[model samples]
Every structure is written in C-alpha cells, then in structure tokens.
Target: MKVLHIIPSVAKVRGGPSKAVIEMVKALRSQNVDAEIVTTNDNGKDLLDVPLDILTDRLEEYGNVPIRFFSRFSPNLNAVREFAYSGALTAWLWQHITDYDIIHVHAIFSYASTIAMAIARIKNVPYINRPLGQLCEWSLQQSKLRKQIYLNIIERSNLLHSQSLHFTAEQEREEFHQLGLNIPNFVLPHGVHIPEPIPDAQDKLRQILQIPHQIPIILFMSRIHPKKGLEYLIPALSKFQDSNFAFVIAGNGESDYMNQIQDLLEKHRISDRTHLVGFVNGETKNLYLQGADLFVLTSHSENFGIAVIESLAAGTPVLITNGVAISPMVKEQDLGYVAQLDSEAIASTIQEFFEHPQVAKQKGDRAQQYIAEHYSWAKIAHSLINIYAKYAKYTKL
Candidate 1:
C-alpha cells in the first residue's frame, strides 16, 4: 500500500507530531508499505535548521521515505501563528492525490492538512485525519472565536469527509466524540524506539549541566509552553526548595512565556534548585533521561506524552497528571504515579518517590519492561497496516 502523509512541518522543534510522522513512515516502510511525506519549509523560524534540504517543490529522501518540501508564505497576522500558506504544496497535492492508496493528514487548522483532505476527497482517495490532541477541550478553548470560525468554515468539513479519525489514545478518541462528527475513529498509541541495553553513561547530563553527583534530578523535557502546565509544576517544585533534588526544565519556547517561568521560579525562591537547560535532543536528551531519578509531565491535556514513554524506555519512573492520556497506562503498568493536575498532588507524588528510593527503582524497571513489550515501532506498524487495509481499496499489506 502507498500512503502519503501531509503535515505542516517535519522540523524536530515542532515536537511530537513531526517526530511521530518520521517514526511512523520509517516503521511502515519496514512492513513493506510505501510511505512518504509532503510538508512546507516552515521550521518555526529561519534559525531552526531542519534535517531536510530546502529545495522548493522538490522531493528529497530521508532514508527510504521521500519528503517533498515546498516554500511557505507567512501571513503577518498574530491570529494565524505558524500557519504556513503554501499554494505550491496545495497544487502539488491536487495533481498527485490519486497516486497513493491512502492519505494521512496529521494535525488540523493547517494549510497542508486542509488542502490535502480537499484534494483527497476530489480524487476519491481514502484519508485518515489525526488531530494530534487539537480536539481536546483545553486546546479548543484557546483562541476560541478564531478556532470556532475556522472549524465552521474549513476543519469541520475536512474532518467529516475523512475516512477515519486517528487518535493516539483512548482519551483522545473519547474526547473527539464530543465534536459529534459521526466519523469512524481509529485508536492507536504512539510508538517509541526503545534503546536496547539502555545507554549507561549517567554523568554526562550532570557534568554538562554542572550539576553535582549527589543531587537528585527531576526532569521535565518538552516544549516550554503554557499548556504543558509548567506554571503549576514550578510551584510544585518550590515545595521542595529545601530538598536535595534539582528540577531541570528543558526544551524551548517563546521568550515571554519562558520569562514567566523564570519569574515563577524566583518568586517561589526555587531558582537555585531549578535549572533551565534550554532545548536538548539526541545524546543529550538520552543522558537527561538516564541521569534523572524521575520524569514528570503536568500537561493540561496531552493526547499522548511521548516524553513519558521515552522516560519509561530509559528506565526512569514518571509522575504525570491525569490530564495526560497515557496516565492510565502508567498507573496500570505501575510505571509511576498518576495524580490530579494540582501542584500539591504533583509535589506529594514526587515526595513519595524521594522517600522510597527502592520502590522508585522497581517502578522504573517495570516502566522499561512495559514500554519494550508494548510500544515498539514494529508492533505499532502492524496495527496501523491493519487499519489501512480495512479502509483502503488495495489489498496488499
């Protein structure tokens, strides 16, 4: 089967959706499915270097998967932040819509996804729409009037016409039902690449960050955005200001929001204990995972916390809020604590881990085992292929 994925950008800084697309395509190819991506050259900023070559309206190969990048035009409007308007990409999709058996549009309220769905519909090609947590209540409430207008004008139709709506977790699938779209839903969790015999150099993160060996590290690795619930996380960490643990905040965000985070740390007098390590990836990310005693994500709403699974794969216990879709699995597998989205609850959970170090270690071991057995890319690929076969006219899988 040939599958074409349309996304806004495949830039690493775009976070989970970009990473998920790359991994999914790679996995699909391994299962004998022909997978490719079409995206715009909007890497969030000119300074952010994406791995893809910036040749306009041309296809480039990232391993076995072909990626076509188009030059994007940005409208000077605050309301439409990060929306890449690419007429070239839209025209290209219209021209080649029927070349693939299936079109998978990732994320919503984007030019690529909306146009791809329209083209796919005109060509009578089946398409899968992954909202990537956009349909959740918390996300939809943001820029409310603007989104409602967009939804009525474009997104609602785009969603209703799709062959299937893909959700990364049961929570997302359930939340999507509230939209009353009457579309078929496919529920599958995001897959992570588990490192075998997990990297053992523990001191790399500490040495690089100038953190001491004895200090316990509580890692939070994701985009530094308001929806991540870092405002609550900062106050929670402040509760342990006198403790020996170091709270590390990684990933990049807008200057104003990041400043707000810094101000919160200072106000609570936890500045000395908290470290903002900026953005980290590759070996540095792995080291942060391995070197830490615990990882936490207090997101307001997450379809699937990829970092939570990454932490588990690294054998580090996690503490996540109920807002995170994967929190149920974390609780069921005994990987870590799942608490209410309250600063008191988060602080208390972290305290429990600190008080019982041996218990934390056991939970971390279970985390690693659970992720390896259930979240492997090969396993995820098979499930997705089955979903595609159910909807696509082509029988080959």
Candidate 2:
C-alpha cells in the first residue's frame, strides 16, 4: 500500500515525534509498504542543510527512507518560525496528496499539518491525524483560549472528517475522548530502535564525562522545557547528594529556559553533582543510555516516553511520573518505578532504586526482553498495516 507521512518538522530538535515518524516509516518500508515522509527544512532557529522541494534519501543519515524537505517560509521571528510555514510544501501537497492511497499527518496547530488536513479534505482523501500529545490537558493549558477557539473553528471539524485519530498512548487517547469529538481513534505507541553493542561503552562514557567509577548515573534525557519539570528533578537529585550519584541532563532547549535549569541546579546546590550536556546523538547518546543506572523523566505531561523504552532496550531501568502516559505500563509490567509528580514522591522512589541495586538490575534485564519483544518497530509496523487493511476493507464496502 502506498502511504505518505507528513510532519511539520523532522529535525532532531523536534524530539520523539520527528524520530518516531522516521523510524516508523523505515519499519513500514522494511515490510514492503510504499511508505515515505514529507517535512519542512525547519531546524529550530536554522533550516536543514538539504536539497529542498524534492524527494531526498539519507537526509537523516539513517536507512533509505525517502523524505521530501521543503523550504520553511517562516521569518526570523520565533513565533512564525515555530509555525513552520512553507509555501512550497503546501503547493506540493495540494497537487500531489491524492497520489498516495493514505495520508498520515503528524502534529496539529502547525502550518504543515493543518494545511495537510484541509487539503486532504478538499481533495476527498482519507487521512489520519496524530495530534502528537497536543490535545492532552497539560498541552491544552499552554494557550487555553486560543487553542479552544482553534479546536472549535478548525481542528475539530478536520478531526471529525478524518478517517481516524492516531494516539501513541492510552492516556492520550482517553484525554482526546474527553473532548467529546465523534472521531474514530486508536492507540499505538512508538517503537524502540535497539542499538548495536558498543564494547565498554559505559566505562568509556564515564571516563569521557569525568564521572567517577562505580557511581550510579541518573539520566534525564528529553527537550529541556518547563513541561519536563526540571524543578522537581533538581531537588530529587539533591536528596541523594551525599550518596555520590551522577545526574546527567541531555537535550537542549531555549536559552532562557536552559539558564533557568542552571539556576535551579545551583539553587539546590546539586550543580556539582549534575552535568548539563547539550544535545547528544549517535554513539554518544547510546553510551549514555547503556550506562545510565536510572532513566528519570519527570514530565508534567508526556504522550509516550520514547527514551524510557530506549533506556529499557539498553538494559537500564526507568523512573517516571504519572504525568507520563506509559507510567501505567512501566508499573504494571514491573519494568521500573512510577511516582507522583512531586519532589518527595520522586525522591523516595529513587531512594528505593538505590537501596536495592540488584532489584534495579533485575528490572532492567526484564525491561530489555520486554522492549525487544513488544516495542520493536517491525512488530508495530505489522499491526499498523492491519489497521490500514481494516480501513481499506471498510472503504470498499
């Protein structure tokens, strides 16, 4: 089946949604599906260094998945840049959307996704909308009135007309249901990419970072934003200051917010124990994952914690908050620890992890098996194909 996945931006800075679609399309292609991606040349403050307005392969430097990068027409202004406006992309989709049997639009409230849905409707095409956690409560609270109006005027109508709403987690789907929109929806989480083994990666990474040997590493990897709840993390790490555990913060964000994190770390006097490493990828990222003792994400609202699964895939346990949608699975499967969104709960749970290091190791080992068996992209791609087949049959009827 010919499928097209449209995302606002596939830049690494965009986090999981970007990575998710790329890995997903790769898996879909491996299954012999004609799946490809289309996105803008939006790389946050800068544009992607790629040939624009045409299909290009190996832009992501991973596999042979075809991705068409269009020039982002957004001005220097951060507000407009975030919109990811692309006239070329819009024109291309307007004329070529019907070329594919199905369309998967990722993210809403953006120029590309919104226009893709509108054009798909106009062209009488079947499309699925993945809000990418935008519809969740904490996300909606960002621009309360503006989003409420946008939903009523533009998004809700588009959703109602679409074939389905694609949600990554049960919690995300449940939150959408509360909107009372009569749209067909399904839950499918993002899959993990199991990395190849790197010899003594843990020790190598520790030496590179100058962290002492045998010290446990608590990793907080994701886009550093207010939503990530770094305030709680500072104090949580502070609770174990005398214990000599290393806290690593991977990922980057706005300078203003990043400075705030620095201040928070200093305020709690855990600055010495914490290492704020800017965006990590490739071998460096894998090393951090492989070496981490606990992967902690104290997000206020997470659609699905991709890093959690990746850490698990690397035989590292996770400690997540209830705000993360997958916390239930993490707890139910006994993969790792789950705690409330406060400092006390997080600190106490972390203490539990350190007290019984053997138990954490056992959990990590179980998590590795669980991730490989269930969270692999190849397996998820098959289920997605089945979903598409079901819809295709309904369309014929």
Candidate 3:
C-alpha cells in the first residue's frame, strides 16, 4: 500500500501528535507498507534547519522513515502560527495527492490537514483524518469563534466526505461524536516503542541533577505548556518542600510562558528543589525516563498519554491525571496512579507513592508486560492496513 501521512510538521515542540505521526509511519514501513509523510519544516519559533522540497536524512537517526519537508509560508505570522500556512505544500498535494493509494491527514485547524482533505476529495482519492483531538470539547473552546466559523464553512464538509476518521482513544472519538458531525471513526490508540535499558542511566541522571543517589528523581518529561497542568503540579509538589525528591522538568515551549512557570516554582518555594532541563531527546531522554523514581504528567487535556505508556515500557512507574485519556487503562492494568485534576488529589497520590515506592516499582513488571503485549506498533500497523485496504485496495494507485 502506498500510504501518505499528511501533517503540519513532525516537530517535537508540537507535542505528542507530531511525535506520534513519525512513529506511526515508521511502524507502517516496518510492516512493508510504502508509507511516507509530507510535512513542513515548521519547528515553531524557528523553521527546521533542513533541506526543503525533498525528503531529507534529517530524521534518519530517530527513524528511517522517508519524509518530504516543504517550506512553510511565513509572510504573515498569524497565518504561520494559527494555520501553519504553506502554499508550497498545498501546491505539491494538489499535484501529487493521487499518487498514493490513500491519504491520512493528522489534525484539523491546520493548513496541511484542511487542504489535503479538500484536495483528496477533489481527486477522488480516499482519505482518513485523525483529528488529533482538535474536535474535542476543550480544544474547540480555544479561539472558539474562529474555529466554529472554519468548521461550518470548510473542515466540516471535508470531514463528512472523508472515507473514515481515526481517533487514538474511545474518549477522543466520543467527544468528537458530540460535535454531531456523524462521521465514521474507529478507536486505535498510538503504539509504544520499548526503550532498551541504559546500564548507568540511574547514575547518569543523578550526576546531571548534581544530587546524591539517595535523592529520588520525580520527572515531568513533556512540552512545557499551560495545558500540561504545571500550575497544579508545582503547587502540589511544593507541599513536598522538605522531601528528599528532586523534581526534574524536561521539554520546552514559548519563552514567556516557560518563564511564568519557572516563576510559579520559585513563588511556591520549590525552585531550590527543582531542576530544569530544557528539552530532551534520543539517549538523553531515555536516560531520564529509565532513571526516574517516578514520572508524572498532570495534563488538563490529553488525547492520549504517550509519555506515560513510554515510561512504563521503560520500566518506570507513572502518575497521571484523569484528564489524560489513558488514565483508566493505567488504573485498571495497575500500571500507575490516576489522580483527580485537583492539586490536593494529585499531591495525595504522590505522597502515597513515596511512602510505598517499592509497590510502585513492583507494578513496573506488570506495566512492561502489558505494554509489550498490547501496544506494539506491529499489531497496530496490521490493523490499520485492514482499514486502508478496505478503502484503497491493495495497491490503489
């Protein structure tokens, strides 16, 4: 199958969706499917420093999947920020969209997704849309008026005409259903790739934090955004003022907002205990995940918690909020703790975990086994192939 996955950009700064699409395509390729991705060099606050208008070896180290990067149109900052406007990408899709058997567009409210869906329909090529939680209730409320107008006039028709929709979680699909567009969608969560153990990961992390081995590392590895609920996490963690745990903040975001969060940590009198490691990837990221005593993400809205599952797959325990779609699974499978959105509730869970840290580590065995059996990209890619074949045939092109 010649499948083309369309997304604005695979920049890690865009958070989970961007990262997810890259792995998704890599998994499909491993199954011997001719899967490719077409995206812009949009890294937010900076364009990706890569060769444009062609597939590059930029991400070959991360995953060998082929990706064609188009130049992002940036005369108007608003257009780039809100829409990720790229006339170059739009024109390319218009010309080559039908070359693929099927198109899988990720996210709505973006130039890449909106234009691809429209062009796919015009060329009579079947397409699938992964809303990436844009149609969910909380997402709709942001820039409410602008999105409502866009949906009614453009995206809604594109969605109704698509062959099918793909949602990563049942909750994501159900929430999109509430929008009442009545499109066909299947729930298929993103798959996890297990990390190999780093022998000195524990010691490496402690050394980086400049702390002793006895000090427990409580990690928050994700994009530093308001949506991450750091407002709740910092205050909750501040309650641990005298505790021996070292809170490590990973990932990066806008400077102003990042400064504001740092201020919050200082105001709560926990800055001394906090270690800010701005953005991490590759082995550095793995070291932190593997070495952490506990991982946490208290997101106010998350379609799926890729980081949470990855932590478990890396043999670490996680503590997450019910706002994360995977919380129920984490709770049911005994993978980790699930706390209410309230700060007190989140703090309470952390306190309990610290009191019985061994119990949390014991759950690592179940967590690793569960992720291995259930969240393999190989299994997921086969299932998605069945869906694609139904609409695109074995080799539609």
Candidate 4:
C-alpha cells in the first residue's frame, strides 16, 4: 500500500511533530511499503541540513521512498484566504494526493493540517490524523478560545470522520478525552534515534562549549518557551547555588522570550553560571549531552520529552518534573529523579544528585540501557508500520 505523510514543515527546530512524521515515513518505507512525504517546504533545499535530518539521510539509503517539498504560498493570511476562497492550493493538493492510497497528517492546529484535511475530504481519499501533542491539556489551555473556535468551525468534522487518530502517549489520549472530543485514537510514542556509541569526550566537549571542567553542568536542550518553564529554572538554580553545577540553556525560540531569560539570569547575578549557545544540532548537540553531568527538563507540561530520552541515550541521568509523560519511565528504570514543577522540588532534586554520587552514576548507567533497549527508532518504526497496516485495512483504500 502507498502512504502519504504530511507535516507543516520538516524543520527540526520546529520540534517533535515534524521529526515524528519524518521518522514515520522512514519506517514505513523500510518495510517495503510505498511511502512518500509531502511537506510544504520549497524545493532545491537540502533536507539533511535540517535538524532531525536523520530521516532524510535514511530515506536516501532505501532509494524507494519519494519525498516531495511543494512551495508554500504565503502560509499566513494570504495563504489562508487563497486556500479558502480561490481553491487553487487545495485543488493542487487534491490532484497530488490522489496518487497515494492513504495520507497521514501531523499536527492538527495548523493551516497545513486544515488544508490537507479539506483536500482529503474533497478527493474522497482515506486519511489519518496524528495530533502530535495538540491533544495535551496544556496545549489547548495555551489558546483555548482560538482552538475551540477552530474545532467548532473547521476541525470537528476532520477529527470525527478521519480513519483513525494517532497520539504519542497515554497522557495525550487522556487529555483528548478531557477535551470532550471522541475519536478513534492510537497511542504511539515517538521513537528515539539511537546514536552510535558516544565516545569518551568529557574534556574535549567541555572545551568546545567553553564550559569549565571543574564545574558540574546541568543541561537544558529544548526551545526557549515559557511553557518550558525556564522562568522557574533560572531562579531555582540560584536558590541552592551549587558552586560547581553550571547551567547551559541551548535551543532557540522567540527572541523576546530568549532575552527575558537572559535578563533573569543577569538579574540573579548568576549570568556567568549560565550559557546560552542558541540551537545546537548534530554532533555539537550530542557533545553537550556527553559533557553534561545531569540533564534536566523543568517544563510545566511535556508530551513525551524527546530530550529526556536523548539524555538517557547519552548515558546521562535526567531530572524531570512529574508533568513530563516519561516521568514514569524514568522512575521505573531508576534512570533519574522526577519531581513537581516547583522551585523547591527542582532544587532539592538536583541537590540529591550531587549529594549521592554513587547512586547517581548507577542511575545514569541504567538510563542509557533503558533508552537503548526500548526507545530505538528501528523498533518504533516497526510498530508504526503495523498501525498503518491496520488503518489501511479498515479504510480499504
């Protein structure tokens, strides 16, 4: 069966939804399924340069899957108006979409998903919806009024009539139920790309990032957003100041939010203790993980903390808030600590890691083993192919 996977953009920095779709396409093709990715990216660009470029690279190895990037026409107000009024964009999409037996659309709350759903319905083709993290309560709460309007006006039909809906975790499914929208749902966590053996580069990596070897480093490698709760992270680090543990905030986002974080660090007089490297990917990203003594994600809400798994794969212990979906896994594997999303809880948890060196090391080792065995993308892809097959049968497309 042929499959078409649609995403807003394949830009890795856009976060997990794009990466999840790329991984899905790669996995489907590996099983000899005819799969092609249709993204709203312009042509003549190198996909490998994108973060989560692994998908593009892996697809090349198979030489069977086709990835096509169509030029996006003013994806803002102009694009919306044209797609809604002219029908040119949607008509073009309908023609191309008919070539595939089924389409899987990722990220529900974007113009991309909306258009794809409309085209699928017009063309009478089977389509599956993967909400990514949109179903999470935190996501809806971020802009409930706007989303509720869209749901009532545009997305309700799409969500109800789709062949199936995919979710990454059970928490996401539970959150969807709380939203009072009942649709057929499937829970599939985004698979982690297990890296090659990480070399012993503690000293080299520290020098590269200009981090002092003497100071312990806590790594936070997500986009700089308020939902990520860095507002609490910076001040909390100052509360129980560890003379040795420094903070490194990587990843990028809205410039104003980033400046606000920098301002907080400076205000706390611990600016020297914090490093803002601004979005590192590939080997540079892995190096930071290797150099870190501990990994921490203090987000107020997280669907499935991708960086948390990355820390585990890098053999670094992670300390996360209970709000993260994978907290149970971290606790079950004895990988790291999980605490509440408060300053005291974050500070106390970090303090315990430094206080118990032996136990901490053991936990870190378990973290590595747990990720390698369970979170591998190869295994994840296999599971996803099964899901696709089930939906294809039901749709009979």
Runs in model 2 lying further than 4 Å from the true structure: 60-63, 392-397
User: lDDT per residue, candidate 4, 78-175, as tens digits?
Assistant: 33522322233355576777877778888787766788888888788778898866778788786789888988899999888798888776776777
lDDT of each: 0.84, 0.87, 0.88, 0.73
Report the Cα RMSD per candidate: 2.5, 1.8, 1.6, 4.4
Candidate 2 colliding pairs: none
Candidate 1 vs. truth: CA RMSD? 2.5
For model 2, what is the error of residue 367's alpha carbon versus the real structure, in angstroms, after optimal superposition? Answer: 0.4
Task: List, residue by residue over 337-395, the lDDT tens digit for candidate 2.
Answer: 99999999999998899899899989998999998998999889988887776654132
What are the runs in model 1 whose C-alpha is more than 4 Å off? 47-64, 198-200
> Which 10 residues in a row give candidate 1 its minimum summed lDDT?
52-61
TM agreement with the true structure for every prediction: 0.94, 0.96, 0.96, 0.88
Superposition-based RMSD of candidate 4 using all C-alpha atoms, in angstroms: 4.4
lDDT of 3 by residue, 57-91 (tens): 45663376798989887654655465788888988
